[model samples]
Target chain A: MTSNASGRKNLTFISRRSPYGSGYAKACLDMVLSAAVFDQHVTLVFMDDGVLQLQPNQQAGDIHAKDLSAALAALPLYDVDNVYADRDSLTRRGMFSDQLAIEVRLCDADKIAEIIRQSDVVFTL
Target chain B: MTTLHTVNKHSLNSDLLTSCLRVARGGDCILLIEDGIYNVRTLEDLAARQGCELSGLQCCVLHDDLTARGLAEKDLPDFISAVDQAGFVALACAHRQSVHWF
Candidate 1:
């Protein structure tokens, strides 16, 4: 699982669920944070309904749920900087990158594959 | 390195299969398990609907799950293979990593 001489393993987390639908999205985020805290190289990819979690101005307070976006915003501070969103998913949802709550690198199918290929572990939810 | 993408939900009920196909690449293996076996019946149709090409992609369905769902090997399409439990483990070992789409 070691990609390089450094002891860090590449961990890729693919979040494919919408925020607040269930605990899947939140649970995945928790895993990502835990992995990052352990000093593993983390990559987060948002695709399918998971891209919906990136939508800005969420009114999650009305539903009595913690704001997922706020947790996501803290990812950068944790050194989990390899953030990406599927381009096709965003387009299918009529969401522009500029409209997302946080900045992320946009990736197409091939690019996504490249990232997954490089990863030593892939977590999906 | 190749990734083994496992899909466990039906496309009609969930878009997990479609989402799995979106990032699956050539040489990567896609194994359908549980309700995902239903995807073998309409994989091409769904891929076409989503405008995703399946060329050079390896697709497989769990034989046990297929049988459990009342499907037989004879009913499978030419492009997809029916793998047994042992084959499933082999596929997982063959790939560098695995991703589950549920």
Candidate 2:
């Protein structure tokens, strides 16, 4: 279903902020998921402290809400694959993909540039 | 061939400015929306020094946001254009895609 111009839109959602403290993260994730439901190709790139959202066993029990980590894990079932994490950001935070519950492709700085270039639409939160 | 980059946050920690600089192409335009209007001066200086071709790429600030923040056009770089919500929508439609940086 890939067309050069109009078949499907390529959307990249970049999350560089914390997931729990604010509504921005949740809103962004919701938007991306909705876009995916419409059959758009979606890519999620987590940078900086955004990687915290992917940490295994996130217990938001204290927050009195559905776990965000659980929602993020359901992305693949919705056909919203291509999750990525910036290598520098992960290393800077002393984390690795294995430490996360969701599988994420490690991307270097150059790859980050490529992601932006390839995306038809990008949202940063 | 037009591409619109929408910057919506004010903090340097947001890294939106860096992202804007990274993906900005020759003919693409940058729009400072929401809290992003504050970046016009810094971006203009960088654009000039980097010799980045911005004449073909319009730089705009949302007038509504500026007013709400108690900022004026004179406070921004002279090259930056100010637009309203209708103009913002027109800009997004004119561009092939829009990138939001927060």
Candidate 3:
């Protein structure tokens, strides 16, 4: 059942936009889940404004927007457990992994670049 | 080793289309979605204008996105193909790499 014969690869989905600014947050999550359903090895990276999506207690009632962080926390259920957040971005925003709803490994810029370089396919939203 | 490059902006509003064309390799696939369809009519014109040397590069647009923007199938240029969500996923799997330009 391995994708090795088919050469399926480590797919990277980068979410660099804010959670509430546009539909990009949902789009990025959808892409990772869809790719995972296809048995692709998927990793999700949140950087820049993207890290803001992981913030806790986001009440978007006024905008009637869905809670993106809730869905982001459900990635493991979709088999997309490789989630990364930029440390500098989180710090710049005065945030930490403890403030996020999901379990994400804090990575530096170099590590983030390494993930991009190693992925067979990357989708940035 | 062709890259399946996806640009989500329109040519008129952003240089992404031209930039993608500038760096595209021969036979590379360019999938335009979201506002990118707004530039479909200009592909031939863009090629001529920039003299982009990449040959046989396949250009496509997402059908659903086009409709969301009130563009129909007939609105797409003859040279540009319309692909669905599944086709988009398949396109990524078919290519060596997939890059989405913001």
Candidate 4:
């Protein structure tokens, strides 16, 4: 068994689902954020419907809850700055870079596959 | 590389199983936890008839979950291995990456 003594581990969180509708997305985000708090190098990739999460100007008021948009705003402060988005997904959804609050790297399908192949750990929500 | 899948939903509609199967590579393993255990037979059958090679792939179920669901090892297909928490960690360590399917 190889020891994880290298100290630096690449952890990627794949959020394929939307945010806030189910506990899955929120829980996954919380865990990744917690891992980042411990100084782990965390990468959060939003794909498919998960891209809806990074949409700007969202209000959860109708659902009677605090807006999750605020949580994403703090990601950089936690040093989890590697936030990515699927380029095809955005195009299919008719969304543009101006629609997002966070600056995301728009990757194609092939790039998304490459990212998953290289990650030390991937959590899908 | 081995991939550990943490499945929490039992419904067939859950894309957890399909997504995992699609990305699984040779020498990789899959563990069915929570409600994910139910997909063992489904996956095996698909692999057999559809020519989908789960090459060097092993399926595992969480023993605690099976017990809680009143299911026994014998109740599951022969392809599934009942594992404990330690086994879960061992599988995770064996795999290059881990994905949680909820």
Question: In DockQ terms, which candidate is top?
Answer: 1
* Per-residue lDDT of A112 in model 3: 58
Model 3 C-alpha lDDT per residue in residues A8-116, reported as the tens digit of each score: 7788887877888988888989888899898898989887678999888888776898888888878889978789987877887888778787899988755655565
Please report, in order, the local distance difference test score of every candidate based on alpha carbons: 0.90, 0.77, 0.80, 0.73
User: Which CAPRI tier for candidate 3?
Assistant: incorrect
Q: Write candidate 4's Cα lDDT for A6-74 as tens digits.
A: 676677888887777787667767988998987677888887678888888878887886667678788
User: What would the TM-scores of all predictions be?
Assistant: 0.94, 0.72, 0.57, 0.67
Using TM-score as the measure, the top candidate is: 1
**RMSD for each of the candidates:** 1.7, 3.9, 8.3, 4.7
Top-scoring candidate (lDDT):
1
- Candidate scoring better on DockQ of 2 and 4: 2
lDDT of 4 by residue, B31-51 (tens): 778787667657776566545
- Model 3 achieves a DockQ score of 0.20
Instruction: Say what the RMSD of model 3 is.
Output: 8.3
Interface RMSD of 2: 2.9
The TM-score of candidate 2's chain A against the true chain A comes to 0.91
Worst 10 residues of 2 chain B by lDDT: B10-19
DockQ, every prediction: 0.86, 0.35, 0.20, 0.33
Runs with alpha carbons beyond 4 Å of true place in candidate 3? A1-3, B1-101
Better of 2 and 4 by lDDT: 2
TM-score of candidate 2 on Cα atoms, chains taken together: 0.72
